[model samples]
Target: MDPARSSSPNPATLAPLDLHASWARSREFGLRPDDALSDALVSPADLRDRLEANARLLTFSRPVIENLFRQIGCPSSTLLLTDCDGLILSAIGDTGFLDRATRVALCPGAEWSEAAMGTNAIGTALTTRKAVAVEGSQHYLTRNRFLTCVATPIFSPTGGIAGILDISTDARANLSHADALLRTTAECIEHRLIENLGEGFLSLHFHTRPDLLGSPLEGLVLFDEAGRLLASNRAARALLQLHGEFPQGSYPECFTTQWRHLVAWAAFGPLTPFPLRTLHGQTCIARAELLLPRAPHGRRQAKSDEAPGRAEAPPAPDTDPRLGHAGTLVAEWHRNRCAGPLLLCGETGTGKRHLLYQHCRDHGIGMPLLELDGRSLAARAQAGRDELEDALRQTENGLLYLTDVDLLPAEARSRLFEAAGSSHRIVAASRHPLAREAEGNGLDQATLARHGAHIVTLPPLRERTDFAHLVHRFVREACPGRPIRVLPEAIDRLRRYPWPGNISELASRLRLMLALVGDDSTELRPDDIPDELLETAV
Candidate 1:
């Protein structure tokens, strides 16, 4: 049944006399039904300022409003968003209806609290701390009698009232289901707020059944690293019958379980449902997800000597005589006490990154590697200075590998040079020379002077003598436990090609061939080569 149309008393609605009593109270507060609506409209400049101040809230609430509009909005309906104090922040809907709404000062920057607009849905919902539907004559103000409005208060993750979401339409329209829709939308916004709270928190998902553990109805409770309770979604609160602030205690205190057992379950194996009983004796199934801290970017250990229970790293590039000059340059740089930045210049797919990884492994450099693209870092720098600072902080006492150094913006490049000064080792890679870019003012000159002491230029595949060894290594890595047999003709075809995309391209081609040669086959023939590779045959 539509709660709005039910003959039984609506919990969200006041008795007819109670609404009249509210109107009497409004009059007692010196508010008149005949008051001019323009008196409540804020200046356009003030409206813009308020919107800018609430930019984050506007971003979070946009999807909810758009979704609700698609579901229930019509040519004669308007949606209003207000801050905690009942000042309209956004009003969006049908153009005609919006124009009509503005006549009653239902636009942005208009204050709609009981003192200003007199007992409307927005004000009533705020004052009563509940969902409210005020229709026609039920409005305390006579001028608002032509509209029906349903409003619900949106709550922040920390349990404070964030704002209000409201739907207002022509009173003649049937809006019996508006209250339910508004409440559902409000709950969705609240859940999203909870998910975006912060990092280093544990999320506990629980439900009456194991199958429902991750469903929308599942309870989500967050805890800090010390296992202290943080916040929870509505489903969690209802399941535990918790009220107000979560009391100071560890997670295991609320259930019949031990903290050590829960920690062991989270760290050791697959997520299995564990039995949990509330203090009230209600049984539930729960699973805990430990959100591990993000590892330094591009950090990988060498796997040339694999041991049991260790992850296998990417295959190392061939150490052929053709790369002797590059290796010598790296060795000299490592020997130098200066320990300045190193720049690696090479064409795309020429194994510059792999070469660096191999160098790190050979030199026994145990520092973590944080890899970032120049263009992406530049974009983040444009967004804010704090993002770049945070990234630099995370890479302290480690190696920062920046790829595509030529693509970094001038300002971002300058900032990066400033941040990287003497604190961390930087290894930058580019298709062109860093000195040339610095001359062009595309890169910071001081950064090049400080770090470009040893610029190693890697030879492309066409100029290298390691073709056969590289092919064998890649084949072995891609088709583990299976013998690789490449026809003589296929080998000649691969060797003669220009290899425009270089070693990376070669690795991909081999992997594809392995996929095509199922368990029944172990041979890679010329016919198995992609048509595109054959089209560019030398």
Candidate 2:
């Protein structure tokens, strides 16, 4: 139910005579009209609103609100947040005006409800289900005759108007951006509505042009086919209006105008797919599909030529020559039970990071990889609860690769593991055996063991028969669109070298040699090798 529905629908019913007189009997009671009325009816805690939410309501017209006022180029800004019954909950503004307004019980609780106050910005906006700017002299109340107040109704998860957000300045001060600022207020309220709703469908809208992103006319619309309104936020209503009437099944248009093109396009394009912007007559008819929010199966690693015999295997993984064999590992791991995480052990040049990223492309996992240095993760965590909660939200169950966990400070080792516990995949890599450091840092032996599952050690270049394959591969790429080959003697020298930095070092050296050699067809020889490689190997 919307907050409005939760409370009385009307505020015209004046406070009970017994309770109204009770405030006159005491100073404390006199100072607080709210306490007097609520107490006579029930109590504060009975309302279930927290003190902080109430406090924020008091300063509703702070600099942030003023900045909004400035954005519209208005001279003064006054804000009022009302209870569901149209009774003022809180009012903020220039001190003098607000103080004066409140004394007349005009601040709150006197009930300037639409029923009592009649058609006005705050009341008419809610009553008509749209933003309203009542300029001076438009007010039904003679007292409100000199003011111009632009008000927009904010909604709850249900389409019901929850409160009114109004910016009241002098009528002469209104600017071109006034309408936009009113819509923005409505949009902000809807965001808070969604956050409260937790999860479900959310629709965003902009009044000026939905295609023109970042316009001030931005707004949001929220609903759940599941609930009544599910947050027909301001944006949703605008979008609905802009699109004309919603299709039969759609709920009420709450706060936006974005559906016209979507409905028009889907209706006209029954066969071949067409562009959404294509217009026929005044109506647009086309198909525009966003990337699917949920893919049925895990993302595949390779997207290349499929194996000839593999029956249902989706496409092969991506092949940037930079990610050769390890890229294959990333793909295969996704297809097979990566039931446990993979602990990749390799030197810097071994392309470990590239391999880890391939898992992101292929896995059905909802979370993308969330990387953090072990030291930073550890330091950021204050207590286990605070740290664990933040990590869980950020990681979203995806891979948490603690790169160079060995380099993490001794004090942080425990907290890092504690934070990693929240993620589904906790893949940690250290060039050295991290097991020994775990003991020194007092890391739980069980946690460290858990992270060590499926360790795949990358071999040094000298030990890899793949080195020759890599050399050949690099040569082919270097001379792409043409033909070039590595010299037999140079390959022999490469095989002989210790190759301390491994494949990455070799790839770099080859790229430099390729650049130096230009388009020459001559096979590379020892003389063509870098002096440093020769000095080290000779």
Candidate 3:
């Protein structure tokens, strides 16, 4: 059974909280308005001096307004979203109206309920709770004569009108043929609202109506941080034979097995060489957001469609089970200059594996990265007892990153030593410092002496200066339009965080945010960031 279907609140009947509030409050707040709590949560102290709810009017309307004026081919359009009262919660139009509309209160806080503006779409849509249009001369106001309007009521999941969505175009223009454009824009806005205010980590759009939202394509889509779909337009849905919603979820869990490995690419540190996958069927990559919740929720969103092509083949696990240390160390090793067989000693997430690969690349070295993760190799050895030994002998001018070097089963260690004796550079990463894990409990003179010259300890993201920008860069890359610039205060919050999962966790959190609140504007407001991110202390 599809999990989302079982959990979703039926959209037909209105929920109690949503019932009378949006429509009624439209009048109460729009005409004689006061502040309402932000959809985001905050501490008690911060709410003392809140701005009026009218502030959200134009601030929120600008995106739609900008899209109408610039993106759409329409000759002229006016956009608005209203509250219960007949006030102009927010309004935007072409330069012609924008200049004249400023003569009245139409900029942000203009009241335009049925009582104030007299039976126009903004008020009538809320008052009658139905969409309406008053064309040139049909409107009560003289200035409305040259315009033809189309409007719809947007609703909360519970069936209450959250706001009104309307478009007014020049009557003289071929605006009658634009029903498809109106519907698509409205749906797109609804999707944005759903992501901002509801449950569910993923949002998938199939091309049922291109006139409503998105381009004319039919395929599966997964968005990057800023919330644009990855690939597979509407057409992919028919191709994949998907009968249900796509997959969306929290990090390390929601994505198919492939995503976890793809994310592991973060250990490469700087952005010098961007390694992308072209063979994965579709070249669509999402600059997706972090999906971790900033607070609690009552229901969950559905999953995004996942057509995982292949599992990336990484080196085998070493004898030790230190998961992340090896990867981070490899990442760091690659960053260091002329760093010899650097001995990486640390717990998981310290990033030893990535550093090793980077080491080879930086030096113009392109040999196969071999692994004698002693335990696994030893198991295969006892079982096979074949030409495997010869393969180990032939890896000349190549790299062998031996993870859990300290746990090298006697035979594998000997092979490694023999290999190290040759020209092959054996960069071994261990969980424990060689001296600490000494075989005799005194000084591990033998093992320590063999891999002596190069030992660099790996540190977690919490201890490194590289983390802030690293975290910022990942979040920005994933969320293309989201203003990833950390608010000075947000940066202060990041500084105080003790990153347990290191870079991986940071990237994951960003993905979560991108999936949740997707605002990729050049200048971002604090609320665009997740509340948990806001709560972080410096």
**Candidate number with greatest TM-score:** 1
lDDT of 3 by residue, 20-45 (tens): 33334434434222222122222334
On the 0 to 100 scale, the lDDT of residue 490 in model 2 is: 76
Tens digits of per-residue lDDT for model 2, 402-442: 66665555545444454443335566666654354446543
**Model 1 misses residue 74 by how many Å?**
3.6
What are the TM-scores, per candidate, against the unseen true structure? 0.50, 0.37, 0.35
| Of 2 and 3, the candidate ranking higher by lDDT | 2
Whole-structure CA lDDT of model 1:
0.68
lDDT of 1 by residue, 1-538 (tens): 5222232223355544545555655776677665656578779998898888776668657765775676674668998889888899988898999998899989898998887888788988887767888887677667888988889898655565778899999988877877866776676666656655554346677777443454444677778877777777667777777776433345766666776666655543214457778766788888775553332332222222233332223235656675888888877776663466677888888878878877865775544455565655555655534555655674554557777776776665555655543556667788764453356545444656754446788888878877766776766555555555666677767887788778877776676666766766667777777677767767
Q: Lowest summed lDDT over 10 consecutive residues: which window, candidate 1?
A: 295-304
Candidate 1 residue pairs in backbone clash: none
Local error of candidate 3 at residue 227 (angstroms): 17
**RMSD to true structure for each model, in Å:** 21.9, 21.4, 24.5
